[model samples]
Target chain A: MKTVAGIDIGNSTTEVCIGAFDDRGKLNFLSSASTRTTGTKGTPDNVRGIRTALEAAVQKTGTPRVYPEILLLNEAAPVIGDTAMETITETIIMESSMIGHNPSTPAGVGQAVGEIIGIEHLSQAIQGRDYIVTVPERISYEAAAELLNAVQGMVSVTGAILQRDEAVLVYNRLRRKIPILDEVAKLSQIPEHKQAAVEVALPGQTIHMLSNPYGIATLLNLDAEETRQVMPIAKSLIGKRSAVVIKTPGGNVRENVLPAGEIYISGDSEQTVSIDAGAESIMAAVHEAGTVRDIAGQENSNVGHMLRRIKGGMKNVSGQAESSIRITDILAVDTLAPVQISGALAGETCMEKAVGVAAMVKTSQLPMREIADRLQAELGIEVRVAGVEAVMASMGAMTTPGTKLPLAILDMGGGSTDAALVTEEGRVAVTHQAGAGELVTMLIQTELGLHSRITAERIKRYPLAKVESLFHIRLESGEIRFFEEPLSPRFFGSVVLLEPEEMVRIEEDLTLEQIVDVRRGAKKKVFITNALRALEIVAPEHNLRRVPNVVLVGGSAEDFEIPEMLLEELANYRVLCGRGNIRRTEGPRNAVATGLVMSWWSE
Target chain B: MQTNKPAVHLYTVDETLPAIREICAGMEEEGVPWKILRMDGTARGLAYRAATDSVLESGIGLTAGEVALQMRKVAEDRPLFVFADPTAEQYRMIGANAARAVKKKRFVTVQAG
Candidate 1:
């Protein structure tokens, strides 16, 4: 009988599979374990996580830590630059003039044009003067209505503004059917005695006047030049259910375009790409470099700061000098990241197209050797590096119930997408490509402008919805679903991730459709793009059509839509794409680790 | 700068005018030119006459009470519907739903054999 242990060190996690084989080759799968990777993948620090995983597996089987006769580690690539690239795009808010806040219910029907005034002096106002009455929360609807009624002939009450949700009640009793805007949370901030237009859309409608720049110009009687300044304010108010446009004397809106620096691609021939050119042009420059040796950002630029942080992180983890870190492969994806408008009055954001780059750095080979030595000394067993990760993954994938030889496998890991093909005669060809699962998360985080990786990961894993009302939510598919109770206020009227356990609120200025689009776009850009690129390299004669079958293995294969998306994308070549069900039990996971032990069966 | 008027105008009774007023308040501010038409008789008669006499060939009948009975009495061919609980929010939703229904080619159709 032979007992072997297989360890797979991934970018974000370390996994181990231990099993025992009888003389007749009957295998008993003992137990499997996983834990967060200690440092970066393909580094000596990975041994710490691997040991924890190994110990956990042994504990499950009630065996000592050194129970296995031999330990096999994946021959992981030595690329380290996957963490080097950074997104240089920054969201800048140049002005605070836009009032895009939507109050649930604004009263009255038609637009009201008048100067805003405090309700305390309704009797003192001129009889013919048009005025918008601002009613504070302390005033009751009946009292405010009576007060407005008393001055009906004395003051022209054109519109009513209230700090309470009395839009319907006040409108019902108003002597003049002027428009009323209610539920202004920051009622004190609204400037008094200013020319304002209160617009309350009917059921199933959006505000048209404030939403259009020309409408604002017409209402405020601004010339062409002045009209240009109010364009942002008008643009921001589009699609809101209701809005109030108060023309403050010094209120001015400006949208700033921040300058993102250029990227320096060092390769066989050195060249530079301006970050301002957008993602497509930047990627084209990176591609033109052909065999990139390293990438650097212009000094004192957003990209430069990102690259420095990445190097510093690597130095902290691997204890290597930051200057020696050479970023080898870069995957640049065009994404829309949410940047908080610097001077936004209502925390409004505009989607900005930015480039998200994930660069792979080349590190010394000593980390893996050191890991092996440490394992050998601790486990009292022979620890050896197995074949390439992709090849081993293919072998592990072959353990799936229906898989056979002459099949190709794509190992989509957190840091890289690796592919391997095994011929009918057992010949194997493997290729490693930068950009995989992590790139997708990074793209999602950047494009959605999510500040948390946890939220990005959740978005990548689950579908999204917008809680439109207290009791219902609109899914990305345009389906409205009701909840038994009122949703949390934090999640109300915001895009949220519908996780299995509960709903997670996303505070970005994105609708359900926009968030869903960002999530799906990121996955396609990284996984689909890398899948095609990786297949071509590993396929016979670099022809993807030559490979008839593809088995996806690794953590990313567990994604709800990735397998189906890949299947559709690869259908043109008649390629059968599927997730690897290792040993008909483990689904899409533990393939590389499982394959390590299976290699000994043939021997 | 566009001065084109809205294709349809609003018509409502006294009880329902508050909600319609709420709806038009926003519409007028945004240059959505619309006028309100008042009826002199019973709610049902007003809606029926408004639906038939309106030039726009569409009318949104607002009612604070029951709407299903009065709406059923209106002719099916006319693009008119009754909105119960005609608050500001409801009218806004009605306009939104109406716009969507027009785009989807299934405006205010009742399911029947």
Candidate 2:
């Protein structure tokens, strides 16, 4: 009988499994440990993390540190993942456009259109001519209402614009109630004398007229072609409580088409594909090129910058010369990037089509043997390099009681998605592809224009809810949650990430539906796409239908929804798919590490 | 004279007791000098007093629920502006002012809800 330790070093974490081989010839599972990986996978710096994980496992199991008969380490692959995004579309306003930014407190309901005029000038204005008063902050709501009341019949005040949160107050005091719009942060930017339309929907309702382009056209007297041009502007203002559209001569909306540039794929033959062809065509071109050796973006275009950034990252991780690193696979997903409208008074954003790419680069073979030697020397235990990571993972996956032979395992980690198939005869086939958890995070941050990876990560991990009222929040699924005490005022009008312990506020003014859409879409794009791609490569005859059972084992398999998403995707093929329960107790994690000990036991 | 000198005071109607308690507790922890002044008039009447009363200048007053349009009309320069008890939706409607006050912990100084 002998005691053994299995250590698996991954992109994001290091895991360890401890066990003792009984005289009965079964490896008895003992304890396991995990810690954040100290450095890039397949690098010598990983030894520090491996040692820490082993120490934890040994301490937990109360096994003598020097008692391990041997230590087994996974022969981690040399694949590296890098992600990038480029905007393909942008909204350009040719002239000063209307402000539709929803102020939390717009006053009154209903639509009104009239020429813009200052509140102070209301009393002196032409009689019987309709006007929308633009009230500056210096004028108190009472004073503005009093002035409007004095000229109520003499000068027609059809509507009012306010620069402060006193919309309700000012609206209540009006002798002749007109639709009032408030919280116009840039009140100074509203061009005076221009025809403006104000629309405020009642509580629990949305403004339909101002949110429509034709509505703005009718108010401003625009022709058919002009109305067509305002659709993008109108689309962005949808679902707001209030909106403002001003008429500016020669005002136009344009779509800014950014140059996506060319991508060079060097496989058996060198071929170039333009990213402008979209994701489908570009992928087709990549498939046609065959046995991809490397991919590079054009010299100065966005794709070029993206590829350079990837190569730079690989160089940093491997300490390899730039020339030795080559991107082996590229997974490109078509995505829409929301770019904020420049100079918009209300925060308006327009969707632009773009490609989100996760590239896998191959470096010079990693010296895992050197790492194993150093770890063995430090721990005073004989250490041996184990089978390929995919094979070890498949072995660990089989420990799940109900699993059978002819099974496939999907190992989705932070940087890559890998799959392996093991037959009853013990023949193993494996494949590694780019795009996983990290890629999903990149897409979320890029598509939402969050600008903060930390915030994007939180959004990816948590559910979302819109703070509709102090006592209640409407979740993405339309379920309402009520709080005993009032929630913090800062989270009052914004979507918040619902964490287990507390509600984390997302700084962006996005709706719960919009944020959830970005997050779920990103997960589907990366994990769902990569899962199918990796399985196809490892399946017999490259046909997934032949693979009967698929068990997920890795860090990403523990994601709240990824396993379910994969099961739904694989159901069409009638393939059994679920997260692995290694040893009937240990979760999807530590699979490769556990498998290492099993391999030695069989030997 | 020193005792008679006007300091930033917190005045609230009976309806805003819950919010006032929290604000006072926070203020106490920060070591800021504060006094609770009781209002004995209507919401609108309080605003008029804040605007004209010399000793009441630059203080804050908490109203019952929503700030009437009348209070906003007169509270522009009154340090004794009435602060209404803000619902989540109404607080968001007020926007930047509420955001700043909440972030800066100047909860007592926020304008009428």
Instruction: Give the winner by lDDT.
Output: 2
The CAPRI quality class of candidate 2 comes to incorrect
The candidate that wins on TM-score is 2
Q: Chain A structural similarity (TM-score) per candidate?
A: 0.83, 0.90
| CAPRI grade, predicted model 1 | incorrect
Candidate 1, residues B5-34: lDDT per residue as tens digits? 433334455645456655543333232244
User: What lDDT does model 1 reach?
Assistant: 0.70
Which lDDT tens digits does candidate 1 get at residues A1-603?
888899988777788999899999987888788899997676677878998999888888764543778899887765544533343444443322344555545667767778778888776687677898888888977788889888877788888878876676677777778777776655666677678877777767888988888888877788898788788777667787766676765676555556777789988888898876776787788778877777888899867776666666566655677667777666777766556555554445565556777666654542566789888887678998876677778888988877777999998878777788999998888766778888888777777677788888888999887776546787877899987654543454567788899988776556666777777888899888889978987889989899858999888999988999899999988888999898788899998889888886766
lDDT of 1 at A474: 79
**Stretches > 4 Å off in candidate 2:** A22-25, A63-66, A268-271, A319-321, A447-451, A463-514, A601-603, B1-113
Model 1 chain A: weakest 10-residue lDDT segment is: A89-98
